[model samples]
Target: MAASVEHDSLESMEAPQTAVEVEETKTFKDLGVTDVLCEACDQLGWTKPTKIQIEAIPLALQGRDIIGLAETGSGKTGAFALPILNALLETPQRLFALVLTPTRELAFQISEQFEALGSSIGVQCAVIVGGIDSMSQSLALAKKPHIVIATPGRLIDHLENTKGFNLRALKYLVMDEADRILNMDFETEVDKILKVIPRDRKTFLFSATMTKKVQKLQRAALKNPVKCAVSSKYQTVEKLQQYYLFIPSKFKDTYLVYILNELAGNSFMIFCSTCNNTQRTALLLRNLGFTAIPLHGQMSQSKRLGSLNKFKAKARSILLATDVASRGLDIPHVDVVVNFDIPTHSKDYIHRVGRTARAGRSGKAITFVTQYDVELFQRIEHLIGKKLPVFPTQDDEVMMLTERVTEAQRFARMELREHGEKKKRSREDVGDNDDTEGAIGVRNKVAGGKMKKRKGR
Candidate 1:
C-alpha cells in the first residue's frame, strides 16, 4: 500500500491538469482529433471527452510510449484508439497496430471499439482469438488491418504456426490491463509474446494494479515510458451511487437476487471470482427468471463472443463474468454492476464498478457482501481510502440462510465431540467401526482353532 501510494504521489506531481473535468472551449479538432473522428463521435453521440481520453489522447498522439494506470470503462480504449487511429492514418502505411489483452472478451470489445471509431476514417480493425478459425484470422491479416486486437496465447499460436503473418512493421503495441496479463501465471506466455515483438515498436501498458511484475515488464518491454496514474475512483465517476452489503457467505447469492429483482434495473453485470461459480449463479438467476449471460474462459470462444455481443448490444441485460471480462470491455448501456464475488484484489473492485456509470450516465454498483468478502472489501476501501454507501433493502432471507448454515455446522461439530465421549466397552469396540485394520502388529484368532496375524500391514 505504501509503495502504491508513493507511486501515485509521484505520478500526480508529475502530471499537470491530468483529466478534463471542465468543458474544453477548444474542440477535439483543435486537440488534433480529425474531422472523421469528430463525425464518428457525433454519430455515436459522444459529445465530450472523458477524463481519461482528455489526458491520454493528446499524449499518445505525440508518439510517446505512455503507461496508463487505469481500470476498465475509463475510456482508455478511446484514449489510445482515437489518437493511434489518427496517427496511423497520417502515416498512411500498410502496417498494423497491436493491442494485447488478458482475455478473448476484452480483445473482441476493443476490436469493436476500434471498428466503430475508425470505420468512418476508413480505418480497418481485425480481431484474433482462439476457438476462431486461424484461416479466418489469416485472411483478416491478409487484409492488413490498421489495428489488431488479440489475446497473448492465440497471437503466439499465429506467430508460430500461421505463415506470412508477422508484426515486423507493427507501429503500436498496446497492452490493456497489463497488471492481470503481467501478474497472473501467464507470465511465461507474456515473456514469449514480448520476445516476438520487435524492440523498435511503440508500447503502451494499462492496468489497475502496478505490481513489481508490471514494473519489470515495463522496464523490459517499454522504452522510458511516460507514466500516468489515473486512480480507479476518478474513473468510476463520482456521480455513481456506490454502496456495500454485510452478510454471511451462505446468503450472498440469495441477497443478490433479492436486491437486483427489487431494483429492476434495465441492464447489469455481475463480476464473478471463477468460471464455474459464474455458471452456477447465472443458472440460478435464470431459474429465478432473469435475463443473464455467463462469460468465462472455460466457455467456447464463440460462446464467449456471442454472450458479450448480446450483453453489449442490449439483447439481454445481466452479464456474469470474471475479471477476465473486466478489461477494456465496452458496454455503454450497462446501468448497474453487481459484485457477486468480491474481488480478491482491491483494484478489481474499482474495475468491476467502473463498468457501470460510463458515458456520463448515472449508475449504481451493488456489492453483495459477506463476512468472507468483508476483508476484501475493507482492503478495497483502504485502497480507495473511503467507505462505500450501503443501500437500504428489505431482504431477510439471507439472514435466515446464514443462520441455518451456521446452526448446521454448530450441530455437526457438537455431534463429533459427543461421539468421542462414548468410550469403548471392549477391544472389539474400537475396531467395530474402524476403517483401518485393528491394531498394528497384533495377532488375531480367526475361527475357534486357527490363530492369524492381524493384517495391519
Candidate 2:
C-alpha cells in the first residue's frame, strides 16, 4: 500500500523536497565524502556540491537506497559516485559496483567520472558496452575492475556467454538514467540482472522523470528507497534562452545555415530526428565549410568516439546528431543547440535543450517548427508551461542561401547514394564506412578539399 501511494504521488509530479533548500555553503566534505575523494573532487574543479549531490549523498553515506529525481546534467553522477566510492574505501572488493546506462556513450562517460573521483585511491573501472569486441570486454571483466559500467544489452550478452565471470559479490548497483533504460525496452534484461545480483546490495536509481515504468521498476529494484528530487516539475534551465523558428520543412537547411552564419564562432549541436537526416545534414554543413560532424547509432563505436572527441576538443564547430546524443553524455562547451527537426516526444525537448545551459553556463536553444510539427511543438510548449517566442531571421537572408544549400544538398544525397553503392560492391567495405565516418572520408576525397578552401566564405 505504501508503494502504491508513493507511486501515485510521484505520478502526480510532486517533488518531495526542492533542491533550492540545499545550503549553497555545503561542500563535498559536508556531504560526508572521504578526504581522498573530497580532494579528488577539488582536483576535478568541483569545489562545491550541486543540489542533487547535497540531497542524495548524505543519505547514501548512511547506507540508504536512493531514488534520485533530477534533470539531465544536474551532477547525478556525483550524487551516487561519492557514496559508492566511500563504501568501496571501507570494504575493498573486486567487482565492487555495476552501473547500467541507456547508451554506450554514457557508459564510457560514467566510467570516466568514477575513475576521476576515485583516481587518488587507484580505482580501476571497465566500460562494458556494445559496438566493441566482446573478447576485449571479456578480458576487461576478467581483470575484475573495481567498477563495471555498461548498457543493459551488452551486459546481458556478457553475463550469458562470458566464462569465469559473475557479479556474485557486487556491492553497489546504479541505474544512471533509469527512465531511459526502461524506455529503451531493457525491462526484461534489467529483470534478469536484478535476479542475478544480490538484493542486499545498495542500489541507486536516478532519472529525469518519474513515469509509470520507473515507478514499477522502483518497486521491483529499490527497497524502502529515499526519494531525493531536485526539480519537481518538467522545465528547462533558467539560463537557457529558447526560441522557435516556424518555416517550411524544405527550407530547414537554409535557415540552419543562416543561423550558423549569424552565430559564427559559437559551438552548435543540431538535433535531427533520423540517422539519415543527421548524416545528410552533417555532410551539407561540411560542404558549406561549417566544420560539421555527425554522431549517431549507425556509426561504428570508434568513429562515434572520434566524432565526440573532435567536437569536445573544438576541432569541429557543429555536431549533427540523433536523439542518442541528447540524454546523459555531457560536452561542456556547447553554445547553441538547434532542433533541426522537432522531436516527436515532447519530453525529449527538455533533454535536447539540456545539452547546453549546463553547469551554470548560459546557452541558446532554437527549435525549427515546420507546419507538420505544430502539434508536437504545441505539446512541447504545454509541457514546459510556456510559449516560445519566434526567433528573428530575415526571410531574404535565408532565401539568399538557398542556391548554395541546394547544391550542398544535392552533393550530400549523391555522396550517400554512392557510398551505399560502394558498400554493396565490396564485402571488405562493411566495417569502417558502414556509417558517417566513411561518408565523411569520401567527401574529403571527392569534394571536401575544394569545400575546405571555401570555408571562410
Candidate 3:
C-alpha cells in the first residue's frame, strides 16, 4: 500500500511576501482541488493533505507561480502533482507540463507519481534522461506525452536534435529539487530551456533549501511567486533514531557487516561515496550471502531502475548507492540508512538521513565515522544542531566477522577488475561507431543488441 501524506508540525522556513498559512487538517478538496484529482488522491491513499500540498495547491490552482521549500519526504510530489493535473483537467493539451529533475531515477520516480495520480485521466508522461538510447527517448517525445519529465542534459539533446519536438505550447514548468539541479551545474542547460519554453507559463520551483542559485532562478523564471516552506530549519524527523559508529577506518566494512547481522531483518540503504565503492560494497555483501544491489551513475538507466524496483519490492534486503539516491526519492519501507561513507557536504547529511523515517514511520540511521572523517562528521552535527549518540556494538562480535569479510572483500575486488576489463574491451570494440559528439549511441555495448521495449507510461 502507498504511504499516506501526514501533517507535519514543522513551520515554514522563510515565508515569502505572498505566502499563506495552511491549516493542518485541510483535505485536498478544501485546498480547492477539483473532484477528479481528489478521487485520484484517495485512490493513491493520500487521505489527508500534506502541509506543502495544503499551502501550495490552492494558490497554484489560482494560477499563481510558487516556490516551495520542504524536506525531501514531506509530500512535495503531491504538492505539485495535484495542481498540475487539475489544470490539465481544465486545459487539455499535449506537453502540458515539463518537470526538470536532477537525476534519471528521480525523473522516473516523478513520472510514476504523476501517472499514478492522474491514472484515471490517462495522463501520459515521457521520461527523458541520459544513460539510455536517445532514439527511444526521441520517439517518446514525438508521441507528445501530457507531461515530459527529464534531466537537463538529455532534454537539451532532444530539443536540439529531435525534429518536430518543442515545448512552445507547454503550460506548466516544474523544477523539482531546484537546488540539486543547480548544484549539478545545469545552469546553461536550464537557461537554454528557459529561453525555448513559453514565457507566460506557470512555473514552480521546489527545493529543500533556498540557496543563492535557487533565488536567482526564482528571479529569472517566476513572477510574484508564493513561497510555501514546511520546515524552518535543518532537522531530521523525530521518528528517525539517529546514531553514529566510531570505528577504525580499516574495520569499517566489518562494523557494517556486524551491524547488519545485529539488525538482521530490517531493510538497509548503505550510502557509499563513489560508484566503485558502491559496486564493490554490493559485491562484497552479495558474496557473503546478502541480497544487496548497487545503484550509481555508471550503471545503465534500465539497470538502475531495476535495482531501485527490486529494493522497493523487498526482493533485495540492501541497496548500496552513492549520493544519487540521497535526495527526493520516496521509498516507504526503508528500515535503516547506513552512511558507509560520510557525506562531504554537511547539507547532504540531512538529505541522506531524510530517506528513512518518512510518513510517520519509525526508522534508524547509523553513520560510520572514522578518524579521518571526524571534522566532516562534526560539521554535519553542527549543521543539524544536535550531536548524534553512538550506536551500541560489541567489538568481539564485530571482529568475529572480520575473517569472512576479508575473504569477501578479496572476491569483490576480483569481480570489479574483471567487470572493468570487460567494459574496456566492449568500448574498444565499439571504436569509431560510438557517437561521442551527439550522445545518440552511447549505450552499454554489452547489451546494445538486446534493446527491450520500455514499459508504457
Candidate number achieving the greatest lDDT relative to the actual structure:
2
What would the TM-scores of all predictions be? 0.77, 0.91, 0.90
lDDT-sorted candidate list, best first:
2, 3, 1
lDDT tens per residue, model 3, 90-176 = 989999999999988788889999999999999999998877688988998889999999999889999999999999999999999
Which regions of candidate 2 fall more than 4 Å away from where they truly are?
A: 1-21, 426-457
- Which is superior by lDDT, 1 or 3? 3
- Model 3 CA deviation exceeding 4 Å by range: 1-25, 431-457
Indicate whether candidate 1 or candidate 2 has the larger lDDT.
2
| Model 1 poorest 10 in a row by lDDT | 446-455
**Tens digit per residue, CA lDDT, model 1, 182-270:** 65456787788777777887788887778898898889888756776666443357778888887677677657777666778568888
Model 1 residue 261 lDDT? Answer: 67
The worst-scoring run of ten residues by lDDT in candidate 3 lies at 1-10
Number of the top-ranking candidate, with TM-score as the measure: 2
Candidate 2 similarity to native, TM-score: 0.91
lDDT of 2 at 383: 98
